[model samples]
Target: MPSLQALKRSARYELIRAGLEGTALALNFGLPLTNPQRGVIFALHHVDPESPANWAPNAWLSITPTFLEQAIEVCKEEGLIPIALEDLPERLADPQDTRRYVCFTLDDGYRDNARFAAPVFQRHAVPYTIFITSGFVERTRSIWWKTAQDLVMRTDDVDLSTFGIDTRVNIEQRAERVALFDRLANAVNDAENEDTAIARLDSLAAAHGIDPLAITEHLTMNARELAELAADPLAHFGAHTLTHANLTKVDDKRLETEMVQSAARVGGYVGAKPTTFAYPYGYASAVGAREIAAARQAGFVAAVTTRPGLLSETSGKAATALPRVSLNGFYQRKRYVRALLSGLPFRLRQT
Candidate 1:
C-alpha cells in the first residue's frame, strides 16, 4: 500500500496534469471547452465501498455511496444533463441537438449497484446503465480479483511456487498483503493466456481454501436480483460479455460467443434486447479493433471503451466503439470528476 504522503503527492500530480486549476474558469464562463454536447460516458464499477481499509488493492474498483451521490450532484451542477446510454446513438447523431449529456455506466453487475447506487440515481432521477456480466450473475466464472483479495486477507501466508513464485510468501502486514494482490494481478495480465492465468490464480486460491466462483456469488447480483433492478425506469441494462474474458486473448469464435450470448442472456433477464454494450476490461490490451468489430457484429448500436477521452463530434462516426472517461475509483473527488467532464485535460498537450 502507498503511504499517505505518497498517495497525496500522486493525487496532486494527476490533478495538475489534468489542468484542474483551469476547470473552474472554464465551467464558470460556460466555455465550449467544458461542454458535453457530444456527451461523456462515465465508466464506473462498484458504488459501495466493500472494504474501508487502506490495504484494499482493488480500492480503485469502488467508491462510497456518498461519493456516488456527490458525483451525481456535481455533474448536474456543472450543467450536464443525465441521459440513458440507450439514447446516446440518437443524441450523438443529431447535429442539431446541442444539449450536454452525461451517461453513467457501471461495468460488472455488482449487487451494490442495485442496493446502493440505484437509490441515489432514483433520488436524483438521473439515468444510468449497468453492464451485466452474465457469468457473474450465474456464479459460473471466477472473479479472480475478489478471490485473491479474500485469500490474502484471510491467510497470513501463501505458497504460489507452482504459479511461478520461487517460495512461499507471507502477508502478515497490510501493505504486504496489498502488494501480494497486485503481484497476483500483474501475473495474470502478463500471462500468455488470460484464462490460463486465471486458472493458475484459481488453483492457488483453492490451495488456500478459497472458492473463486463463490466470491462472484457473494459480490454480484443474481439473475432475479438483476431483473428486480431492471424494473426501475431510471436503470438500463447493457451486456458486458460472459465470464468477463479478455476479448483480445480469446479466439474469434470465443469472442463472438461471449458478445452475442451475453447480450442475449442479459436481454432475457432485463426483458429488453440490449442495444448497447461495454467491453470487458475495456482497455486496449483487452478490447481492440477486433473486439470492437465483434461488438458491432453482435448487433449493438453503441459500445463503450475504457479509453480516457470525452466524446466529441466525430465520435459518432464510430458508433460501435465510442471513447469513455472512467470515473476512476482512485479519484472520486468532485473536482477531479469535474475536470474530466470538462474535456480540457485530454485537449491539453501534456495529457
Candidate 2:
C-alpha cells in the first residue's frame, strides 16, 4: 500500500506537472510577455538509462542518455550557450557577452556519469561540474536510498516494527516496496548518524541475504575513475560533504568538518582544491545561512542548493547560497526543458 505521504507527493507531482505543461505552452506562444535574462544552472543525478528499471520509485533521479542528449539539444536550439560554473563570474561581469548561459551539474559522483553523461557533454563541448561525497568515494558509506530500494526488491518482505512502521511490507508489491523505501529513506535522513542509519539498513538487508554494499560497489565512482574524470578539462570537481549528511542536522563542528574535509579529499584526488560545494539534500531545510557561511569559510568559491529558480545578476551576490533548476525526472520532455529555461514558471511563482 502507498503511504499517505507518498500519495500526497504523487498528487503534488501531478499538479506541478500540469503547471509545467501549461507554462511551456504559454512560453511557446509568448503569452508570458517577459522572459528570464539570466543564465541557468541545471542539477542532475544518475544519468544512466538502465538503473531506473531496478528502482522504479526513484526513477525520477535517473534520466536516460537520450533525454540528456535531447535536453542539451534544446538548450542549443533556444540560443543558450553552455558555460562552466567557474566561468560564471567572468561571464556575468562581461558587458559584451549578450548570449544567455547554462551550466550543467551532476551530483553524487555516480559512475555512470563518466560512462554515459560525460560522452554526451563532451560531444557538445560543454563544461560541467560533478560534486563528490568523500565517504562514497572512500567506500566507507553506502547510499542508503539505493540500499533501501535494493533491500525491498531482493527480499520477499521487510519487518519495520522496530523503525516505528506498524506493518511488514510485502516487497513483491511495487507500491509496498516504494512506501517501504520512502520510510527507510526518511529514517536515514532523520538519523543523527546517517552512516549508522545506513549500517542498520545494511544489516536488515543482510538478514534477508543481500549485501547492500556489494550492490552499490558500482553505483558511485571509485577513486581511480574520479581521477580520470578530474583530468578532463571540461569536468570540474566540487565537494558534496563526506557522508552526504543533512547539514542542518549536524552540529557546528561536524558540519564544518564535512564541508572542509570533503573539499580537501576531492582536492587530494583531483590535484587541486575544489572551488565549489553542493549541500547534501540541498533544500532550505538542509542548507541555510549557517551552512552557507560554513561553506564560504571552508574556501569554496560558491555553493549551490536544489532550490528551483533561474539565476540572475543578484544571484552572484549570494554566491554560496545560489539556486539551481533541477532537470527532474518527472519532466524530461524537451518542451519542458525549454519551458524551465524560459524562466516563465519561476517568474509566475514570484507574482
Go through the candidates in order and give each one's C-alpha lDDT. 0.82, 0.82
lDDT of 2 by residue, 154-230 (tens): 77777765445565767777777777888888888777877677777878777777776676576888888889988
Worst 10 residues of 1 by lDDT: 1-10
Please provide, for model 1 over 1-351, each residue's C-alpha lDDT reduced to its tens digit, 9 standing for 90 to 100. Answer: 544544664677576545765775666676655354475888888887554564466777888888888888888886778999888888878899777778999999998899889999999999999999898988889888888888888899899886877479878987778778777887887777888888888888899898898889888999899889988999999998898888888899999999899989999998997989998888888878888888888889889988778777877778888888876566667776777777777767344
Among these predicted structures, which one has the highest TM-score? 2
Clashing pairs in 2: none
TM-score of each: 0.90, 0.93
lDDT, residue 218, model 1: 87
Clashing pairs in 1: none
Error of 1 at 210 (Å): 1.6
RMSD of each: 3.0, 2.2
**Deviation (Å) of 58 in candidate 1:** 0.8
| Alpha-carbon shift of residue 265 in model 1 (angstroms) | 0.8
